[model samples]
Target: MLRNRVRELRARHGYSQTALANRVDVTRQTIGFIEKGEFSPSITLSLKLAKELQISVDELFWLEEDLDE
Candidate 1:
């Protein structure tokens, strides 16, 4: 499954959901959904988030485990 390192990064940067959302120009609910892995963002949104977080897209998201066929 695709996993995101949002919570870790946000904690490292000392940002609450609302604060991070404002910085990324998204809603707090969006951040919450992203953190919970309940929603996958579009490429544009992903790039925006990475840019705001000052990290690469790969750093923000990655495969948690190999998928089984």
Candidate 2:
């Protein structure tokens, strides 16, 4: 599964889901889904998220297990 520190980073940045969504030009539902691990962002969206969050994409996203390998 893909694991991310989106929620933690969002809190540290003092942003609500809607606020972050607006910054990333995505919907609040998209943020919620990503946070819940029910959805994964596309590369473009991921870059946008990383940029908005002031972090690297690698820092934001990772694999919880190397199951695919």
Candidate 3:
């Protein structure tokens, strides 16, 4: 499973979903879904988000333990 630290990062940066999405070049709904763990972004989009949030891609997402296979 894909997990994201979007909510935490967003809170840390004091950014709303819409603002974050705008900075990341995605829709606000996409950011909402990402924060809720309801959607996994493509690599390119993930990179975009990481750049916008001023963090590394690894910091934004990780594989769940059970999915280690």
Scored by TM-score, the top model is: 2
Please estimate how well model 3 matches the true structure, expressed as its whole-model Cα lDDT: 0.90
Error of 3 at 3 (Å): 0.8
lDDT (10s digit) by residue, model 2, range 1-69: 888999999999999999999999999999999999889899999999999889999999997875767
Clashing pairs in 3: none
TM-score of each: 0.84, 0.91, 0.88
User: Could you say which candidate leads in lDDT?
Assistant: 2
Give candidate 2's whole-model lDDT: 0.93
lDDT of 3 by residue, 30-66 (tens): 9999988889899999999888888999988997865
Clashing pairs in 1: none
Residue 28 miss distance in model 1 (angstroms): 0.4
Q: Residues 1-68, candidate 1, lDDT per residue (tens digit)?
A: 67898988889889999999998889999999999987888889889888877899999987676467
Question: TM-score of predicted model 2?
Answer: 0.91
